[model samples]
Target: MNTILNFMKRNYKILVAILCLSVVFFAFNSNAKKDNDPERDKLLLELLTFVIEKGHYSPAAIDDAFSKGVYKDYIQALDPSKRFFLQSDIDEFSKYETRLDDDLLSKDLTFFNLTYDRLMLRMAEGKKVYKAILSKPFDYSIDENFNTDYDKAPYTATAAELKDRWRKQIKLSTLSSLTDRLKIQETKAKGTEETSEVKSDSLEMDLLDKAKSDKGVENSAPKTFEELEKETRVSAEKSLDEYFGFMNDLDKNDWFSVYINSITSRFDPHTNYFAPEEKERFDVSISGKLEGIGARLQKKNDYTEISDLISGGPAWRGKQLESGDLIMKVAQGNGEPVDVVGMRLDDVVKKIKGPKGSEVRLTVKKVDGTIKIISIIRDIVEIEETYAKSSVVEKNGFKYGVIYLPKFYIDFDDKGGRDAGKDIALEVERLKAANVDGIVLDVRDDGGGSLSTVVDIAGLFIQEGPIVQIKSAGRKKEVLYDRDKKIEWKGPLVIMVNSFSASASEILAAAIQDYKRGIIIGSKQTYGKGTVQNVIDLNQFVRNSAMGDMGALKTTTQKFYRINGGSTQLEGVRSDVVMPDRYAYLKMGERDVENAMPWDKIDAADYTIWNDNAKFKQAIANSKMRISQNDQFKLIEDNAKWIDSRSEDNTYSLNIDKFKTAQSSIEEKAKKYKPIYEYKNSLKFNSLPNEIDALNKDAILKEKRERWHESLAKDIYVEEALNVLDDLQSKAVTTKAMPVKIKKGKLAKS
Candidate 1:
């Protein structure tokens, strides 16, 4: 009876396993059938639309108005310069401008198909028009003007009008070349006159006789106006050919990306759709590393041209590839070479990027027009060129460390990869070992990265406190705190920001300012980008749908606020010591972006103010006084005004003589600002002692460090920042400590 019981139990277990397998098999079959269904794209579209509507933080209602917005944005994106799609084409597309919402509901793409087909037709016509216009030399003597600001321009009404537009556009481009050539010739003539011996009257005749005896002129004649014009026309033709070739490489997926992004953009500028390949590119950019040939490729006249070789990458190490070399074909490990000419750049990049240690051979056309085949073994290229680096600057007998963090970079999937917080901590430790009096954290042009990393970095400068406040739609506000009680550096600290410093950069700068831990300096304000985004994998949303890799949707799911209850959306963090710079009057911040979220305030988080000294106001006043007296800064302010004036003048003269006169006038006026570029401070900058040996070992790295040091020696901003640091240090020695005050749950000064 016991043996009979054991047999029954074993059979029952087998039966359960069989049932489970059957269920999985049925589910797999169902998914497979769905994948083969013709309505897969429609289902995927529905899923995407639903996700955006349900998941976006500030989702816009998809009605007739929203559809109209999508239509206008999409059409503008396709032809932003107004170079394609005539009035007739726009009229044809306008018919469905209000019907897009209905089509989205039904999962139909009639509007997209119609607009895409018309764009293709117009693009084909544009290719021929530009080529025909560039085939012959342009008459630059015509007194015509081309307004570069496309918004004020109107669409062409007929083919003849479009052709005339193309002619003017091509003429404007050719005029630039003509002006450049003329300048070069004038420069050469000036050099010749400066070096040449005085020609005697008899010597001139003797030279002519000698030339006749030799049957040729001794020196090559300078290029004439007509010859220069022909050369300019040739160059313009080649450039246009490359431009049209790149346009031809745009496939359905490319146009679809633009279309889908237009839809996502209605929510916010930060929200975007990243196709599979685009996602990979985004990862590479953030991590600053990729496993590939390590060359930047660009489309040029039916060829994939190498634009740049990444320092220390496989191609750069190989020493055979170079910028301007055209990649004609690619082969894998002695396999048959596949012609990549006329292929899309992304597709060619895929063929070249492979697993590390794999061999790829490329047939390349060198810049000098020589063709050669070269093999390269792919490797992981680390773009350490833009990573955070620190240097010591000696000013007023005190050494100040300057840490330039280009971005807050982090690899999400690689646990062992580089982290900005950890790297910055290590840099701080190095600076401390050097016994620097103060530190200047430069986040100029840093577009920001990983939020967690910013919080970690901000924690280094202060004791435990709330770093930032995050609030999502329909969710409670959460305060991110630095739980750690240890401080990394307690010396005088200053953060330098600019209009390009954004997101994570603003977070650290704002937190440091709020806690009174450091003084902020540089531009009038930082880039206002307080939104948080997350890239969602679309495949995870579909259970049984057969759409292959529907890409990821980067949606802004939350908004961040300063610890002091202020949002950095439109009103970014204002610098305590504002300085005039090139972007001072430029519209280049979050306010410049379309569909940007409005700024608002939230409840301030609890925090403690640093109470080291109470001379912050005096320090800022001293800095301002110095800036007002400094001639370099005065020049900078004037230069900023000049740049703003130039940016406002968009109209250009097509006449060659007038164009040259304008160019010459600008160059002459710019001569006064030459001193700005030539100014050199007395400060001496050096790498940390521990890093000197490693830098010397790497030639490329050594050159980069040398260039960086040279730039620092000439940077007026760094000079001023060091002065501020010195002032802060001087005041700390004499000023008494003040009691920490809290106002409305925020750090306040008494």
Candidate 2:
């Protein structure tokens, strides 16, 4: 004991010496940074110049990168109208140029707080400028007023400008003018006599004639503002009014600004920004009930168009609201009507979204050139609210287990029994206990839910392995391994998906494909949204700053990927067999969106492959042949063709005379198919008009779910998957089934 104590005392001195050296190093590193390190400050100043002077973006973008300890702002800053930022301000702002070496390394909250306060002031100023622009004049004119060399994002075209004219401003006339009279000016020392001012009247006219042809064969004539103004002013005024309301409303009404400000306060795009009211509205949107007229609205150009109407909702119940109506104005239950034309989309949404049981009148413009007022009494849209469903399908004379994963969803707002993953798992177990031949996990149209639950749900399929990889700014890689090795169902498995199968759904589908554990069947590709987002609360990033006093927002912080390098982008997982459905006509996918993060690859990690790699190609071939001959597929194809034809056109015009004939021609074709299911509308479960009365939420909640057991006979995708499973079950199957991969040539030609 004495010897050990002596040894410890001797080593303690060494430890103390090491600790003292570290402290000295840290202290010197923090304070010894040359206050006038022009090299560091020079780069900072240059970055500031590049961002403010050359970039077309928001100052918040610069601040976003700055907060993340990014010494360099790669993305430049632009005004709200997207005019290039002033370089002088960036150069002058060097007073706050910080090294961020030791303080950030030590995770000092003070450092973060100081940065936050500085950025908040900058961001506040940026917002102030934007507000002024929106308020001072409701400018939506682009031709004379819109600057051409700015960031031309759809939402960022805030200047009063002619719609979409910025796209044409890249011509040589706008960029530079060509002229030749160089030799006219000569030095005093050497005055050359080689140049004549011009030849004669004939020669000048000839030159001018050639010059007219030089402009281009297809010459474009710029619009005369006085001539165009008569028609454009109405639109311009409406746009100005809308933006004016939004800018004024933003002080307290539009919390979205606060949320975005809060998120960018912390880091570049890592944090989240959500308006306070929007957050509440988000809950109601997924919960399937809200006030105002029930309709899914989206901004298209300068108009707010109806996207979808929830069946049985107030809008649908009113029966006058159509899918493509333009909401020109909205009046609060008999109040003074306000024009909504050329308005910011969110502002329109704010006016449209309200509490249930309220009255909201829409001055809507129908597809047929007519305007009318539609009054709707809001109610809790029950069908839109619940995810309750039950399906019965029979396969191969024997009953196959039918399980539906309605969504990768969980009501985080609710406390007990709020787990969607667990609910799906329970359903699967119930189906398996029925002694069924096969199991189907229907993931069609599921956007996503909790990531933690996704990992848990993945464990229910293949034996333990890494399910996903999460990467952040610091290159921190979190491998979410499925340690739970419990196999839920060993029977033949099928996963049904569609174009809407997204994040969590893709993870499951990818896992199932990776392990050769199940057959994937659905649309040509899923939504391909495999990336993840992190919601950073604004107040947390700002430290002691009073940022907490602001509202919250969630930003798209980081992206997620599979254990393998490739992320799902334009192409989602190819299903084992494609299925024909109504949504096939819908032109929706991640590829259709702008400014979406692209698909990329990273370093590959080790993964264990299972032994089920036989005959997948042959299975795919067989399924394709059968689908080609199917009647349902032909109908779906025809509809998709019509839908595609409409989407390809940039402009649409309706001939009211021929329009009636065209509308009826299409409706007659749709009447060939009878309704698949009758609508059940009632408050009480028993009173609900339907054969699926026993399959109500109350019955499922009470654990009386055994009342129904169905098969997978009718579903095209499920049937194909079963056929593939049967082929796999066969020992006769030898070579790989013909790969069910998408041929770009086929898609391109189509």
lDDT for 208 (candidate 1): 32
Determine which window of 10 residues in candidate 2 has minimal summed lDDT: 1-10
Which stretches in model 1 have alpha-carbon errors above 4 Å? Answer: 1-41, 192-220, 318-325, 363-375, 543-546, 730-743, 746-750
Error of 2 at 141 (Å): 32
lDDT of 1 at 86: 94
> How well does candidate 2 match the true structure, expressed as C-alpha RMSD?
19.8
Q: What is the lDDT of candidate 2?
A: 0.50
Candidate with best TM-score: 1
lDDT tens per residue, model 1, 1-750: 000001123333443344334333222224543222335556545656766665567888789998898899999999998888899889888998898888888878788778888899889888888878877777887898888888878998999988888888888877876776666556556766521222123423343355445767545456688987886677677767767777777777678778878888888888788877888877776777889888888876677889888778999888899898999999998999999988888889999999999999999999989999999999998888657899998878898999999888877778688878888999999999999999999999898878888888999999788998888787788888899999999889999999989988999999999988898999999989988877666666445545466677777767889999999998889999988796698788898887899999998887778877465777889999998999888998999889988886888999988987887788778878878878999888999998899787677788889999999999989888988888888633455466576666744676
User: Which of the numbered candidates is closest to the native, going by highest lDDT?
Assistant: 1
Candidate 1 lDDT score at position 11: 31
